[model samples]
Target: MLRLSKKTDYALMAMKHLALHGDRGASSAREIAEQYDIPAELMAKVLQRLVRRGLLLSHQGTRGGYQLARPATLMSVADVIQAVDGPLTVTACSTDDHACDQYTKCSVRDPLWRIKDRILTALAACTLAEIVDDTSVPTIPVTLSRRTPAPVTER
Candidate 1:
């Protein structure tokens, strides 16, 4: 199943937290971790990775903490995910590694690659600002309007 790693999830949470408090100055990793009930050590690692990726700025000292390197609107979900988990791949064949033994006869590889592209595009379209601003809504609307069939008459 396609799923985001836990580190990516934590990174998104931390980014959203910072975005929400962008005007409040930098926030310590501990603060963000405590706010979301995540492990402080893990959050620190995630935040450090973000910093290395240039997505976040880290400060040092008594009041040191972390903040977004750029506006949340300019940072896409894909950015955070990629920073912590690398590229998004729905199938083994979708990646350049291509270690699958069936590479020579993989019939679904092309379709899977297309699907992976679509997923990545969708993630890219979603910015951290949308999440932090509570504006993240599905592009496609879903309706549950199926009618219930009447009970069959007894014979």
Candidate 2:
């Protein structure tokens, strides 16, 4: 499964929160954390990383926190993911030399490459504003769960 790291997830959540609130001023990490039920320390670290990445601007002292360094509409989901998780490639071979033994004869390699490109492109096209404003439609997947029945109890 393609999953985002907890750090990335929290970062997205924090950014979304800021985007939703708009440019009223900076938001403290503690405030954002408490509002979102995230750990203050972890969120603070994520926010700091975002600041260093130029995605957010941080203010210090009493009435200080963070604000978007750029407009939310200008920030892409891929940007956020990349800032935290490095690259979005699903396979190790996607970014570097073919480490897989089947690379020489893999029939699915080309198609997989195409899929990765399409996915990254799509993600790049989507912006934080689109995610937080609800102005755009999102494509979410619905999975059915199959639960096994429990064994009969002993007499």
Q: State how far residue 33 of model 1 sits from its true place (Å).
A: 0.9
Off by over 4 Å in 2: 138-155
Q: Flag clash pairs in model 2.
A: none
lDDT tens digits by residue: candidate 1, 1-155:
99899999999999989998979899999999999999999999999999999999999998789999999889999999999999788776655666889988888888998988988998899899888877564575557668977889999
Best by lDDT: 1
The candidate 1 region of ten consecutive residues with least summed lDDT is 133-142
Can you write out model 2's per-residue Cα lDDT over 15-76, one digit (the tens) per residue?
A: 99988775688899999999989999999999988988899989999978898988988999
TM-score of 2: 0.81
